[model samples]
Each structure stands twice: as structure tokens, then as C-alpha cells.
Target: MQEGVIVKALSGFYYVEDGQTIRMCRARGVFKKKGIIPLVGDKVTYTPIGTREGVIEEILARRVELVRPPIANVDQVLLVFSVKEPELNLWLLDRILVHTERARLPGVILFTKSDLLENGDECQLWVSAYEKLGYPVLMVSSRTGEGIEDVRSLVNGKISVVAGQSGVGKSSLLNQLSPELRLKSAEVSHKHGRGRHTTRHVELLRLASRTYVADSPGFSQLEFGDMEPEELAACFREIFELGQQCLYRGCLHETEEGCAVRPAAQEGRMAPWRYQNYLEFLSELKDMKERRF
Candidate 1:
């Protein structure tokens, strides 16, 4: 048996790479009987059937699982956003951060198209805001090759998922990182102020011997799946740290008397935008919970 990782899934066939070469494989019948659907980034064991084919016999346990793009065992997420185009969507960025936190996966924030920003203050403001929340923020311009080395160093020897909304230069960044990929990218529509869907599937591309990165399709909407309204605060690193100082044991931090978070926001201790987005997410989750019951 050979141990390998599934790099791609297409037409019910899995492409498993075992360092030396990639082999086309099909999962055994036992997996279907057990209601298991193998996904890209899955560590698995398979038996070689012939020169180019194999049968996956066992699937290793996953460390992280994402339902939106259906990937497993992800080590980290690279959240990409453009500094100017379509404008920086802090709310959406926070929502994605919440998703990573719930999945217990670390995330890095990458601001693409930095070359387009006229002044340094624009990038500095965003960098300072998210870095305060304990996330590493990198300013990268695929056109200028700025911070590309930093990005390459971060994803080396790990399973990383690159995600962001349309028109954020996600595909352009990928192509810059790995020129051989030649991933199709589209121009942002000036009229709509958004990018068209260029990446249509989720597939893991081998970067180095042990480094792999999965390119996920760009999306605009994110739902707080299976997340409780009360648990929302814990997802925000800054809010979670400050909640300990609140007078109430279960403070929602929304107009609640003696709420440390609110005061911190008012005093500029925390970014007000992040605080407001937190409230919005909390309310949305509450409504989702009510609809479920």
C-alpha cells in the first residue's frame, strides 16, 4: 500500500500524488457503503492496480473540513482581497475569518493589488486593523511581484486554501506564484464593479515536494453554518480576549450594560467596523437558529 494525498477529484476519479508521481485512482466500494465521499486534500492509502491506476483502500482522518468548497485536512487559509478594486469588504473578510476560526484553522490575510493603492495609508490602515486581531497580514501586488516571496514562504510545505470574493485578483495571484499553473483569470467588469467566475472547481496544485495549495472558486455570500449566536464572540480574536473583562458572564456585547467590548470599541480600543460586523453576524446567526427550529 502507498500513502498519498488526493490532489484532484474529477468524474468520480481521484488523482493521488505520492511525492514521486501522480496516479489516477478510484475509491473502493467499502467507502461508498460507509457514506464516505473522498475529497481533494484527503490523505489516503491506496493499492496499485497497474502502471497508471490504483484503488484507494483507506482514507486518513481529516484535521479540518470545509463544506462550501468541500475540502478536508486543510492546514491554513489564505484570505485574498484587493485593496482598491471593488473596495475592501471588511464585513466579508471578517465573515471568512469567522469560518476559519470555527473550523479551528489558522488564516492569513493577503491584500492583493497593492500597486493600485495611491497612498501607503490605505494599506497601512487595513494591515494594522487585522494584525491587531492576531492575523498576519501581507501586502502583495501580483503585477509588481511585491510580497510574493512572503506568500510563497507561508504556503510552503503545508495544505493551504486560497479564498476570496470575485474581482480580488485571486487567480492573478495564483498565476504569479506558480506561473506554470496558468490559471484562467478574468478582468473585473467596470459596469458591475465585480469579477466574473473564472475558477469553476476546487483542485489542489502541487507547489513543492510537500507543499500543496487548493484554489477555491470565488464566492460572495457566506453563511454561519452550524454556528451558535452566542459563540460568535469567540471567533473574533480581539473580542474573545476582551470578553473576560466584562461584568456579565455571558455578555453579548450589544448594548449590554458593563460590556467591555462596547466600551473598547467606543474608546477606539477595537476597530468599530469589526465590532459592527460582529454584531451583524451575531444577529444573522440568531435568525438562522430560529429558522432551524
Candidate 2:
């Protein structure tokens, strides 16, 4: 049996790369019987049928799994945002970070289109805010090639899910990294100030040994998905740290007496936007929980 990673899923076929060549393969009937769906980025073992075909025999256990785009064994989430042309959406970026934390994965944020940025202080402020939470943030421009090598270094030995809203230079950055990819990219619309959906499916593209990125479709909406209200604080780094200091055992940090988190937010110890986003997410989770009853 040959061991490989599933690079793409189309129709019902899987294309696996075994460090040499890609082979089109189909999963075994038993997998469907077991309610198993092989996704892109899965490390699997398969049996060859002929020169260019094979049958997937077994799927290895995954390190991580995502539901929206449906990928597996991802080491990190690469959050991409643009400085202009459908400008930076910190709200959306924070939302994605919460989901990333919920998935128990590390995330790095990249501000794309650095060339269009006229005010570096605003970018630095954002960078400082997120960096304080232990996330690596970079300002990158595909046109100017600034921070391109840094991005390459960050993802050199990891499997990252490239995600963001459309027209944020997600695909363009990859193209600049390696022109051979030639991934389709669309420009932001002048009318709506949003980008057209350029990526339609999930596929893992190899960059280096053990370095693969799952280029999935751009999306603007993501649900917390089975996450509990009380468990939300743990998804935000600073809030999780401050929860230990709360006098109440189950403090939600909203109007609770002796809540260290609220005071910190009020004192500007944490970025105001982050605390606001946390409250928004917390409220969302509570609403969802209430509706379940």
C-alpha cells in the first residue's frame, strides 16, 4: 500500500499525492458504511489499480478537523484580510479567530494589500492588539512582495487553511508565492466593494515537504456550531486568562461583581474592539443556547 495525502475531492473521486505523483482514487465501500467521508488534506493509505488509478484503503487519524470547508489535519488557520478594496473587517477577522480557537488550532493573521495602506499607524495598532493575544500578525502586499518571505517562513512546515472573504488577495498571495500554482483570482468589484467567489472547492496544494495549504472557498459567515455559552471565554485568550481571577466560579464577565475582565476592558488593558467582539460572540452563543430550548 502507498501512503499519501488527499489533495483534492471532486464528484466522488479523490486525488492523492504520494510525494512522487498524483493518482485518482476512490474510497472503499466500507468507509461509507462507517459514515466516514474522506476530505482534502487527509493522510491516507491506498492501493494502486494501474498506472494512474488507485483505491483508498485506509485513512489515518487527523490532528484537526473543520466543518465549513471540511478539511482535516490542519496545523493552523491563515487569516487573510485586505487593507483596502473591501477594507479590513476586524469583526469578521475576530469571528474567524474565535472559530479557530474553538477548533483548538493556532491562527496567524495577515493584512493583505500593504501597498494601498497610507496610514501605517492604524495597521500597527491592529498588529499590536492581535499580537498581544499571542497571534503572529503580518502586513503583506502581493504586488510589492513585502512580507512575502515572512509568510513563506511562517507556513514553511505547517498545513494551513487559507481563509478569508473573497477579493482579499487570498489566491493572489499564493500565486505570488509560486507562480506555478496559477490559482484563479478575481478583483474586488467597484460597485459593491466586494470580491466575487473565485475558489469553489477544497484542495490541498503542496508548498514544501510536509507543508501544504488547503485553498478553500471564501466565506463571510461562520457559526459557532455546538459551542456552549460558558465555554466561549476559553476561545478568547485574554478573557480565558482573566476568568480565573473572577470571584464567581461561572462568571461570564458581563456585569458580574469582581469580574477582572470587564475592568480590564474598561481600563483599556485589552483592545476595546476585542472585548466588544467577545461580548458580541458571547451574546450570540447565549441566544443560540436559549433558542435550543
Candidate 3:
């Protein structure tokens, strides 16, 4: 028996890495009987059947799991977005951040193509705003090699999931960080204003010793799953914090009387766009609840 991590799953086979070598593996029949399906990023114990093949006998406990891409033990999510090209969709960014918060995963915002921005005043504004809200923000350009080292330092010794809209340069950045990866990348379509989906599936690539990153398939929209309307505000850190001072208990922070969060947004103490997104999400969640019954 040996201990290793399952780095990739393909066509009913799992490729497990045991530091020295990778072994093609299959999960034990007991796991299927017990309704257990192995996922990439799962740590497991396996028995070597041959030089390069094995059987996974036991699955170690998982630290975390993401539903959309279905990867496990994720340490953080690098939410990449382009400052140009497709343009910065802050609404989309905020929606993803809310999901990350609900999953209890740390998320870093990476604005790609810094070199393409002729006037970065708007980009700088967004960076400052997110940073003020205590989220790690990095402006990276794979072509110019800017902010690559900062990204490397952040994902060091952690299992990171690189995710965002298509054409935000996720694959390019991964290639820049780890050239050996040679991950496929595509240009954004000028007609559609979106990047073609180059990454077909999720596979963790080791960038450094004990540091793994997964380049996930790009997605533009996501639906909230089984979350209450009241829980939405808590996902926004600044809103949740300021909401404590609201005069009324159980305030949804949407035009409520004496709402501290609304006042903070009005006074420029909080990002108004983010606050507006919060209200939008709150409304969406409310509508979802109404549709449930």
C-alpha cells in the first residue's frame, strides 16, 4: 500500500502521483458499492499492482470540494478577469466572489492583460476598491511578465483553482507561471466578445514542490444552490460587517430603514458597485425562494 494524491481522472482511470512516479489507478469495488466517486485533488491510499498501475483502496478525508468543476481539497480560487478585451465584468466578478465566500474558500482577484490597458485609471480604481475590502488583488500580464512573481508567491505551497470567464488569460498565466505546463490557450473572438473554451476539464498541475494549481474550464454564469436570502449579505465581507450596525434586526440591507451598509455605500466608505451587486443578488435569492414553493 502507498499514499499519494489523485491529480487527474480520465476515461475511468485515475492518475495518482506518489512523489517519485505517477501510477494509473482504479478505485476499489467497495467504493462503488458505497457510492464513492474519486475526484481530482483527493488524497488516497493505493496498492501497486504493477510498475505503473495500481488500485486505490482508501480515500482520505477531503478538506473542501467545489461543485461546478467538482474538484476537491481546493485551498483557494484565483478569479481571473481581463481588464481589457472582453472588458471587466465586475457584476460577474462579484457573483463568483459570493460563491467563493459561501464555499469558505479564499479568492484572489487577478486582472489580466495589464500591458494592453493604455489608460489604467479604471483598472487601478477596481484594484484599489477590492484591496480596500481586504481581498488580494494582482494585475498580471503574461506577455509582459508583470505580476507573475506575485502570483507565484500567492499559490506557493497551496492547491489553487484558477477560474474565470473565457479569454481572461487563465491558461496563458498558468503557462507563464509554469512553462512546462504548455497549457492550450485561445484568443478572444472579436465578434462574440468572449474567449473560446480551451481548457476542457480540470487537472491539477504541480507548479512547485507541494504547490498545485488547477486550470478549470471557464464559465460565465452560475446559479446559487440552496442558499437563503438572509445568508447572501454575509457572503459580502464589508456588507456583513457594516450590517451589524443597522438599527433594525434582520435587515436585508436593501432600502431598509437605518441600514448601515446602504449609508456606507452612500458615504463612499464602501464600493457602491459591490453594494449594488449585493442588492441584486439578494433580490435573485429572494426570487429563488419564492419559486421553490
Candidate 4:
């Protein structure tokens, strides 16, 4: 048996890369009996059948798992957003970031299409704001190769997943990093102002030894699954850190008296947009909870 990582799973087939090459494989039937579905990024051992094929013998332990798009053992979330084409949607960005926080995964913000921005003021402001919130933020133009190396350094030896609005250059970024990928890309619809879905499935593409990246389907709609309304605060890094300043216990930061978060947002201490997005999300969660009953 040889040890390898499952890089792609499609139509009951898994592509496991053992560093030398990616071997097409199928999981043991026992896994299906036990309800053990394999996912990309899962480390496993398999028995080689011939020169380039094998059967997955076992799936090793997973470090972390993501519900939406269903990938496992992800080390980081690459939040790719385009600045121009479809325009930057801060609401969607914050929405996804909140989910990342909920999963306790480090979210890296990569703003694509830097070439469209005539100036860096907006990106710099966003960078300064989000970076202060403990998320590493970067601006890159795949067309110009600006800040591509910085991105390369970030995902050098890690299993990072690329996510963002469609046509935001998720595939383009990966293509730039590893041109060998030649991943298909589409243009953002001029009429609808959103890119058509190019990536239909999740597959991990290897960039270097021990380094892989998964360009999953882009997501514009994400729901907070099974998370309580009160759990939203801890997901926002700024809220989690500044929440310690709340005067009262069990404070939801919405209606609590002497709550530090509202005042901090009111006083420009914390980014107002972050707090506002939190309120919006909290409202959505509350609405969902009410609908449940």
C-alpha cells in the first residue's frame, strides 16, 4: 500500500497524488457500507493495481472540514473577490468571512483584478481595515502578475481553498500560480454582472511538493448552519476581541446596556461596516430561527 492524498473526487473516482504522480483510484466498498464518503484533501492509503491506478484502502484522520462545498482537512480559506468586473460585494465578503470564523479557519482575503483599479486607495483602505481584524489581506492582478508572488508565498505548502464570486478570477489566479493547471475561466456577464459558474466540482490541484489548492465552485449565497444567533459575535475577530470590553455578562451586543461593541462601532474604534454586517447576519440568523419554529 502506498500513502497519498485524495486530490479530486468525481463520479465515484478519486485522484490520489503520492508526490510522484496522481493515480486514479476508487475507495473500498466497505467505506460505502460504513457511510464513509471520501473527500478531496483527505489523506489515505491505497493499493496500487497497475502502473497508474489503485484502490483506496483507508482514509486517514481529517484535521478540519467545511460544510459548504464539502472539502476536508482545509488549512486556510482563500477569499477571492474581484474589485471591478462584477464589482466588490462587501456584504458577500463579510458573509463568507463570518462562516470562516465560525469554522475557526484562518481566512485570507485576496482581492483580484488590481489592474482595474486606477488607484490603490480603496484596496489600501480595505487592506488596512481587514488586516487590523486579524485577516491577512492582499491585492493582486492576475493579468499583470502583481502580488502573485505574495499569494504564492501564502499557499506555498498548504491546502488552501479558493472561493469567491464567479468570474472573480479564482481559476485565473490558480492558472497564474501554476500555469500548468490551465483551468478553464469565463468572463463576467456584462448583462447580469456575474461570472458564469466555471468550476462544477471540487478538485485539489498540486502546485509543489506537499502543496495543493482546491478551486471549488464559487458561492454567492451562504447560510449559517445550525449556529445560534448569539454565536455571531465570536466569529468576527474584532468583535471577539473587543467583546471582552462589554460591561455586562451574556451580552448579545445588540440591546444590552453598556455594551462596548455598539459604542465602539459608533465611535469609529471598530469598522462600522463590520458591525453593520454583523447586525445584518444576526438578523438573518434570528429570522431563520424564528422560521424554524
Query: Candidates' TM-scores?
Result: 0.95, 0.95, 0.96, 0.96
Clashes of each: 0, 0, 0, 0
Candidate with top lDDT is 3
Model 1 clash pairs? none
For residue 107, model 2's alpha carbon misses the true position, in angstroms, by 0.4
Q: Give the local distance difference test score of model 4.
A: 0.88
RMSD of 4: 1.4
Give the per-residue lDDT of model 4 (tens digit) for 97-147.
888887888999999998899854476777899988878989999999999
- Candidate 2 segments whose C-alpha is farther than 4 A from its true place: none
Look at candidate 4 and give me any clashing residue pairs: none
Off by over 4 Å in 4: none
Cα lDDT for residue 87, candidate 2: 80
lDDT of model 2, residue 126: 89
What stretches of model 1 exceed 4 Å from their correct place?
218-220
At residue 104, give the lDDT of candidate 3: 92
